[model samples]
Target: MFASEVLRSVDNMASKRSNTFKVLLASLAVAALGYVLRSPSLYLRRETKSSLGYPKDSLLNFTELTAEYGYLSEEHKVLTDDGYILTMFRIVKARNCHRAKRSPPVLLMHGLLQSSDSWIDSGPDAGLAYLISDACYDLWLGNVRGNYYSRGHVRLDPDKDPAYWKFYIEEIGIYDVPAMIDYVLNYTGFQKLNYIGFSQGTGTFLVMCSEKPGYCDKVKLVISLAPASRQMHTQSKIFRTVTQTFYRMEGLLSMTGLQEVFSKGGFSQEFVAFFCQLSGVTERLCEKVIDAFDHVDSTHLGSITNQTTRVLFGHFPAGTSVHNMARYGQSMNSGRFEKFDYGREQNLVLYGSEEPPQYNLSATTVPVMCIYGKNDGLVDTRDVEWLMAQLPNVLEMVKVEDPQWNHMDVTYSQYTGDTIFPKINEYLLKYTSA
Candidate 1:
């Protein structure tokens, strides 16, 4: 009997060994496949896009998405002084409102991994783009250099050129934002336009104002939503992990020839985009994934339906330089809002200092209003307080009234029109002629 029991235990041990071996072999096979393919994609195997590396309609832009919703979106290509060609979307007419003959031009800039698509993702009534248009403001959405919408350049190909990816937030401040501002001002024939920036948008604007004090005169007022300047006090682990290990991990990623991080071609991106498109169990999983960083509020789920969520993820994790993420990481470690750190020797050569210089908030002369969320994990209240203390012309500051409001909710909440937009439009009206 004892011999039989020992034999049974040995059989169970063999079964466990076999399962472990199978898992190891499967993992190796996947790694090999990913390496051979030069990329891993769930659907795309062949290269379809000819002008650039990606396929057309492979991802939709703000112009395309907004037009589908019965809005007239004009696609404008603006050339940056640094040679990048950026696509900026303008929503001059919407079904909800007649074309504004004399309304002010409002430039709404998105955050990290976000583009103009984010503004329209929440549907017409609640989406910021539609709401702004409904409010009779001529809405313009700005896309930064490296995002999916604005990936073109006169000389540098984002998929091939390593030098194109060398810029961080400093460049976005000095180049991208200024370029967009000039383009909008020139296009609309306006002396100054209203600026609304979220996260990195706010960061870039802050940097732009600091570097070129005269640019502040070009903006009537600044509406900063979830303003991400000093991320030192961020609560999200994902934000912490990326910003902290960025120096080493970014180098490894760049060495792998990955200029665009988690770009549209990857299996991981497709998988997440597809799975989040599903309802029931899949959507719940997506909620958990987004909530891990932004914090959870079930009421805010309507802004991110399956269809809209797919568009958001597909266009997003969009693509940016490894350096931009690294810049945010640098901000997480540093005390003051400053330029990118090039360590010691490079810092002296670049900024004539051993350390990166702080952005002069005193020069951000535009009347500013900051709207922060209580439950936001990425941008904390402490960080917002620090930012407020430094800036000279803070017009007003308010927390999202909802106790459960998180970072994502500031954009994704279906109730934002009811709760947030009234306040935003109030401040924007102060500068507008109407």
Candidate 2:
């Protein structure tokens, strides 16, 4: 009898080891395929570079690019309570425009795996940051903790410290957003500041209000462009697949200490940037690659110009922790906008319950204007309706008038000046005394 019990235990252990090995192998293949996709050099011909002109903007950082466009730019650093050192950018006004009247401060936060660059990447005419500044609003851009611009900590090394990469959207809401809010208001001496968040940026602001209810009093209004929280009905199968791959491999990744993904200045990101520098056919193909990730149809590609596409690759796929990706996966699967789930055992310890807590959307009392694309691949209208129903104060819900507008179009679309910015400006004017 004792021998039989020992044999059963041995078999269980062997089965567990075999399962772990299989999971690791499959996860590695998925990771390698992603890297290969970004590595355009492996598949493309050398002649493609013949006519390609290198984008000078690729080499320019946020402040440099702003200055190049004749905008007065300033950089400010804010240290989070938990030791993250984030860099925030400000466009005080156009260098050429001299308005004696002081503009009210309005903070613009970028989405996941993006930095301050997204707002200005499309140049002065269409870029949200430039337009807001041109309108005499004090424009401030906020970068989350782990992206390209804000990769610093008081003690831990990003490259060496696995602990440094352990944060997700929850931490951004509870720590990063509040820190930026306090800094911008303190420096500008404003009682409140307007906020504009794109994609995950919207999620972070919602999380902030949900987690720290008092912070809602500090915002005059929130302009949510392509707002996303739960992606349960997202149309982008590719994005869902990638998120699931990371979610399933979390245990193995935690064990191996592999935490960050698509880091800025990494080989994959740089190669994608180089490939995008090639003009004509190659650039068009690169746009298709972006389209697939965005889950937009081919017809939707008309909204973004070739130059905008090239400039976009220069700084995008910025970087985020693996845990952050997994958090999205959790929401996608469970169809709930909630805190990070740490498995049944760890969740009990951290949350005092087997299930993670759902964000209290009712606590978000700030007047919000939600602008979403009908064809957005990452956020479905159903989810947006669900979110609206939960919120106590939704000032407006404006779907992009353009039928082809998708997730990327919210920031990079050439038609935003005609399609969306007017409404944004109108909403801001209503809330501002200036």
Candidate 3:
């Protein structure tokens, strides 16, 4: 009886051990499944326009709209230099609108990680481009290389090749901006043109003057909104830290072929959706964080919608090349627009060691009127003041009184007309001939 009892007890213990193993395996499987679902692959599948927590269509109608499609047309064409085919859009406000016979035409440039579509926020009204065009100004929107619009015509494919993806604001300043400006001036039969840039758009302008000084003469006037000259003293600790971290990681990723992985649309869109979900939790939290990074006043948080928040966070910044991020880091650290240090500071050659040269502000003889917001985070008021002090001839410097106007508010905020457009119109009209 004792022997039988012993055998039965051993079997029971074995059974318990087996059950425990099964339970642990099942728990691990569940945890892994949850993780995979949240991974980029699964996230991409569910994170579409609908999944990003955009407002109901009916609700969006209530918001102030920018411009309609009627005012814009798209074309795929090659730029004069380097034969780089770029996506271009032309905006004509009036059929025969002519400024003073000598007044330069205006070319509008969008910032990094954004497309021309950014200028037009598709709801009820027109975007900045339409507003300027409607005010009787000939507006031409220029898309930088690698955004959804201007990705074209090179030996490198934005999708398949690392070379195509290898650029930052410096490249935009050196190649893309100059190419577009040349094309626009030549296409319009104008000798000099007015230039307006926002955020990275302004950074590229600085780059242009630094790398290609002759191009500055082609520009008659410049209007820089939220200009970023030296980013060493940026307001956002998070941006500073994150960008710095990414800058250091560029080498490892480049060697491993993971740099190009981010360029994939599937991965990008999924990442965007995941962030959008977080933004939806309480639009205020998201806006506050954005405000913190951008240096905007948090009180104006109500101005941004969940959709806009998602779009800006998810799609706008997108995947930047590690090399590009490193350059920004070097610029941030040095407080100068130097070429990205690829390991050697012009001494050691890893990739391209030539530090991007600093822009000569003295050469920017164009009549410039800078507009900045006190609450802007990306371009601090101090930087704007510093930039103004550097410029040889500044037509005017206007700081908006509204605490709500953020860096992006210049283009995307509803209060643009009340706080910004009126002032811009006042300046433009001063130059306009009756």
Candidate 4:
């Protein structure tokens, strides 16, 4: 063949290759832009909203409700060793009831994405803060780091710094729990405080006991309500989807400044509140949406006043680390309660192991009473039993008698005060002088 003919053929092939490379680059650019545009927080705004049925006597925040209820409440700013500034609230006593100044202190820690408001959103009639105060226990509510109330940090601003988002349940268990516990014990002048935790609250406490067993000595009797660990058997498909699919987007989302999950005043929460209050068809479906994730006890649903549901959800899923959600997902996949997975190579560097270390449940030596519902989907019965077996000193396991008593109902249900609190009160009474 002629040299020119051969050169011409080579040039044509080079031209074709150039065009293909250009197309590939353009496609990648479009895909990156698409991911940026699809911000996770805004994904839920694709709906027409009418009303939220916001309470006529809506309370603004935990402190606001404390004043409205005439309860004595104080807010404390605790600085974690890891540079997170967490907010914790305390209810000294019930204003309506006369209690001795020396009332025993009880610290109630809320679950994942929840804040101090969880204790009071049910109103004075049934709220745990009020009932505890009325029961003569100096009640305190703790907001874990990354929630709405505890979003501040000593060195990092959550809104502006990506580094601020570099934590999960492990950091919370190790840093936030111990800091808050020490703060509460110091402030209350108590040798040890009675402790109660719900969901992630229970998980963090258990983590604290394992990572820092000394804290367990400061807790008199730990009550775990709907304890969340090893979510292997979680019934909520959405929860599992989030732990799996949605969590996979965290790196991309955070790169676009969407690190905070379920951001307040964001589209997702607004859409939920608005859609949940529609008159007939949508309303029932919305209620079922909640029931599907938690249990659907009609009696409890009936007791959940419009104001309660409206106010409670407004503060919930408040915010947390993307890593936190991802870790929970890993737990579901691995069927073991363990530390966050930072890939295999990174895990070796960070943890000196190929896989993340399982939380040392055996190190949790506190006298623990686990209260779980048969219908609780988040913490399956089998998972709770596994948690019980792992704990070194689980005193008892109380299964909620009401077959339909799902997770949230343990705190927000209509009969929570009657059915659950009595048992809790009895336990507290038994250990009151301890």
TM-scores, each model vs. reference: 0.85, 0.88, 0.76, 0.84
Residue 89 in candidate 4 has what lDDT?
85
Q: Rank candidates, TM-score, best first.
A: 2, 1, 4, 3
Which parts of model 3 are misplaced by more than 4 Å? Answer: 1-69, 80-83, 93-104, 122-126, 260-264, 271-289, 296-302, 310-315, 342-357, 432-434
Residue-by-residue lDDT tens digits, candidate 1, 364-422: 98999999887787888889989988889998998988777777766666778987898
| Per-model CA lDDT versus the true structure | 0.73, 0.78, 0.60, 0.72
Candidate 2's residue-wise lDDT over 16-97, tens digit each?
4565434433433343355412222233232443335657665678889998989878899999999999999988658545
In the range 1-434, model 3's lDDT, one tens digit per residue, is: 22222223223333345654344334323332232111243333322545545433311211122213344344535462544567767654332334433245677887645666566552224256656766667667777766555667556665567776677776777788888888777887878777888878887887788678798888877888888777776665545654675577667767766443233244434443344454333343345445545554434454555555654444444234556655665656875545565544653454343554456777676678888888776677877888788888898998888766777776667556567777676766665544
Q: Give the CA lDDT, 0 to 100, for residue 408 in model 2.
A: 85
Selected candidate, larger lDDT, 2 vs 3: 2
- Which candidate do you rate higher for lDDT, 1 or 4? 1
Candidate 2 positional error at 2, Å: 48
* Full-model lDDT, candidate 2: 0.78
Better of 1 and 4 by TM-score: 1
